[model samples]
Target chain A: MAEHDSGGWTLERTIPSETAIGSELVSGLLAAMQEYAWPAAELFHVQLAYEEAIVNAIRHGNEFAADKTVQVRLSCTADEVRIEIADMGPGFDPDSLPDPRAEDRLEVPGGRGVMLIHELMSEVTYHPPGNRVTMIKRRPPSP
Target chain B: MAGFERLVVVDKEDISVVRFVDRKIIDASEIEQLGAELLSLVDIQQRKRLLLNFEGVEFLSSAALNKLITLHTRVKRAGGTVRICNLHPQIREVFAITRLDRMFEIASSESAGLAMF
Candidate 1:
């Protein structure tokens, strides 16, 4: 996809709810971040957020249904990076997710993905039903 | 000694120093395999101490974090211990954000991790 509204580059893909396909999409997004010279720390944040979103889409949202697919749109610019992911499966409420950091839930392995995404991204929002998520990380001002 | 596709395990005294094969541990199947291999050290081989050395890991998702937490749980249940060391700053930030840094015993170097045992 052509860069939208002065973003240096944009990518849009509808990938199957499969791990291998999701990994390729993540690699492409990271490459764009590298090309834009995002700092190493910020790049990790983007990578973590995107990976978690895609995996959540496939595993939790789509339930790995062969018939379902995940829609992904990524835009990278000098000023900020944005990605939107949506799955076709039944959606759930994000607020219902227990805090993985809570003493009672700290040992639970699966609930940390959404927590980490919110922690690392500059901004995160879940649309109605919570099957779709939008995350943005603005570039930090140069020292 | 069992063959390992995702880990390079070295014995240092009573601890097994484990290093990951991939720089970014985000792949699903790989993470599953990694979790299995790590648990094998405690379950099958009966290792009591594990020190995961994160010298080369640059990026990892929460899936990978889940594996580490599982490993920690299994090891502790077996009356063993898990210590992680050499995390790059960004990786360290992930643990901090998840509060896993508090859950895990983190060391600055291999020697320090070994010293914990």
Candidate 2:
């Protein structure tokens, strides 16, 4: 974890494939966002997207394997927040995911996490092998 | 009525008006428990109509949305229905982004949600 003179903070951690641990990390990020006075609605968006990404890493990427772990790095500045998450499991092709919004798929319960992450974040990119994902959310314009 | 740790359920006529006890429905275990409790409304208690009130809920994840979808599916299969109301603006935007706003009936007030049934 590192903090810079630019008033930005960065943190990197490798956590066990446990949702509780991920939640703790997220709580810390939320506190940092609050200290920076991130807008309330944007805070909700960050929380939702961050939670979804971490859960995907643990549940789908690692399959909750006891031997596997998830890597998370978060950086925040006055202008934007960036998050990257990677897992120890085999990667998947994001292109292969179905459109959750299809009329026929509306009733389906799963598969919305990836979509939500894409929509909520300002920008999203998936790395090679597909196990690593990076997301960015720019601060909304001041009212 | 059976007890629920995650929800507060009150029967209004034939509809079960349900409100969540947690402000943020993000925890994995808690989400699983919430799913089970909701399913019980149809499976065990035989509730035919449900109105989920999200008055104070400020945050929820895709996992929580999955539970609601599951409950909706079960209710439909049991010849019942589920309606949700009072979602915070951000939470409501989540539904819109996922297009779940098209999948579930959403109302601005409890009375409107109850009226949908």
Candidate 3:
């Protein structure tokens, strides 16, 4: 819990595309959330959204290039957890992606991450050229 | 049988039952491994029905769902069927939100899921 001072911390790192950093970042973020003292269910939601963000940045955004770098920013505060991951690839129109929820696309295995990100997080906005995403999850009220 | 560290398998009659062993989040390679094991059960062993039991699983990533979709396609081609049961609440919500619930036959219990096949 003493990973940082009582004050919140903000960090930025250019993630190596070769590294699949979702699990690690989520674990670290969960650890970092100790100060906020979120409930288990709320914490799980944050973890899921963070996983999708990091995966999208590394997988689709950077195309898993060893040399390409994915920029990651993590900020933890008492009220919310915010993350931004940007990749160095040609951005695609999010609208062009097929909706996984559509009956025709249900048989297919993709198009879920973005939807999950938006649903799990309190706020999710794509940055133009569409290569970067900012996601936020507000801490649940104390019971 | 011991299925790589994250998965457990039990043969019950004609049903090939697969269970996850822990609460940890499964990554991509592990997902592929699970998919391969399922494919072997359906393809090599000619098992026509699969029951994926998730009572022990604490979380299911999109990667894990992808594995299920892959298995579904493979089994469907062989005239076999894949059914899932005991999905964790969050996982169940994921399947629902993604509308995968509409395509995959999901049941509440292992017996119910197995009966579907």
Candidate 4:
């Protein structure tokens, strides 16, 4: 894990595909988000989105194999925070995934994670080979 | 008396209430254990009314939420009712965004949750 705050705030962390590490990583990201003065609601949304992405990378992309690594990057600008997660295993097509909110899909446990991420994040994009997902959260407009 | 690191299950007026102790993330381990415990509430103990109190919980992954869905399904299959209460606002928004709000009976407080059953 690398945390750099000299001129700009950045964090780059790499973890093996171990489910046990999921919470600790989420805590780290959330702590940074708080320190960056993220609004409480937006912070929570980012937290939710990031957790879904990281867990998906660890569980589905890497198949929970300890040999595989999931790389995460957190970078911040004045108005936005961006997160990128990449895993070692072959990835799946997000488009082909079922909608979790669909009446028939409600009972199925598999698709909600991605749905939550897409709903919470402002900009969500998947990279080539579908192994990495990037999410951006722009600060909400002033009330 | 299988104790969970993240949940405290207490009986109240014949209601099985599960309060999450973990303030932050409810990961896969917690979710797996929670799922098994909830299943037993119906499979072994034959509980008919349940309430999951999310008072202290701030952030939970889809894994944990999925487990809750499983618990809801099992309790329903057993002809029991599972109601949730005290969701932190953000978590409540998650339920709304994912449209899980329609699937489970949710209340703003414990008393209201218990009253549902």
Best by lDDT: 2
Please identify model 4 stretches exceeding 4 Å from their true place. Answer: A1-7, B1-5
i-RMSD per candidate, Å: 1.0, 0.8, 1.6, 1.5
Give residue B8's lDDT in candidate 2 (0 to 100): 96
**Model 4: colliding residue pairs:** none
Q: How does chain B score by TM in each prediction?
A: 0.96, 0.97, 0.86, 0.90
True contacts kept of each: 0.79, 0.90, 0.56, 0.77
User: Model 1 chain A, poorest ten-residue lDDT window?
Assistant: A1-10
Q: Give the alpha carbon lDDT tens digit for every residue of B1-117 in model 4.
A: 355566678999789898877786556776787777767778887988889999988878788788788888888888888889999998898889878899898999998998988
**Pairs that clash in candidate 3:** none
Q: Pick the candidate with the highest DockQ.
A: 2
Tens-digit per-residue lDDT, B71-95, candidate 3:
8998999998888998888788887
Best of the candidates, TM-score? 2
Position B24, candidate 2: lDDT = 86
* TM-score pick, better of 2 and 3: 2
CAPRI verdict on model 4?
medium
Per-candidate local distance difference test: 0.87, 0.90, 0.77, 0.82
Q: Write the per-residue lDDT of candidate 2 for residues B3-103, one digit (tens) a residue.
A: 99999999998999999999989889999999999999899999989999999998999889989999989998998888999999999999998889987
